[model samples]
Target: MNTELPALILGGLAAGFAIFSIGLAAVIGPKRFNRAKLEPYECGIEPTPHAVGGGPGTAAGQRFPVKYYLTAMLFIIFDIEIVFLYPWAVHFDALGVFGLAAMALFVLNVSVAYAYEWRRGGLSWD
Candidate 1:
């Protein structure tokens, strides 16, 4: 018997189960529809129409501020830094001084960007 056969079977079972669950939900779940339900919801904020372009035409939803994207990017950067740090920490002894130096440099680079953002008010919500 192949060693990977069990893994393949488990994966197939998981996929089949997921598909079955979605199909079951669609068939049995409530189909209620209303105007309020159909409208876009954003953190309890009422949806408002805004101009898509600088022209006269208006769109259905408000455009997000650039600060939202900036905050998300910063979160992702720090999250990725934590991800790299985890593996390095787990293999700390094996990697020795080389890993330490590499991680130190990585952290320094990230800190510089963090400081720059702080100084530029990128971290501030307002």
Candidate 2:
């Protein structure tokens, strides 16, 4: 009863389950196709053909609200920063002054970037 053997077996089972679920879904999924179904739909609006090299008036790579992307990116950046900070905090005694200063610098850098972005209207909902 080796521990490694069970771990390996579990890993293989998980992989097989993933493959099986994907295969099942592919086989059971709907086969119907239509212009509306195949086309890209955004906000219930149908896509329009794009001119060569693209243009703003056309649907070809048209501009969207940047706030959505910026908000998501800011969320992920802060989330990862918090993840790193948590581990360091747990080992604060071992890290000592060097760790404290390093974390301070890290936070300051993030704060400056955040301030710059905010001032530049990146954080604006409008």
lDDT of 2 at 6: 91
What is the Å distance of residue 77 in model 1 from its true position?
2.0
lDDT of each: 0.83, 0.80
Which 10-residue span in candidate 2 carries the lowest summed lDDT?
A: 44-53
lDDT digits (tens) for residues 13-112 of candidate 1: 9999999999999999999999888877665444455654445555555545566777888899888887888898899999999999999999898899
- Model 2 scores what on Cα lDDT? 0.80
lDDT of 2 by residue, 25-123 (tens): 899998899977876756443344654435756545544445677788888887787788888889999999999999999989888988987899877
- Which structure among the candidates has the greatest TM-score? 1
Model 1 TM-score is 0.60
Off by over 4 Å in 2: 1-53, 56-62
Model 1 alpha-carbon miss at residue 31, Å: 12
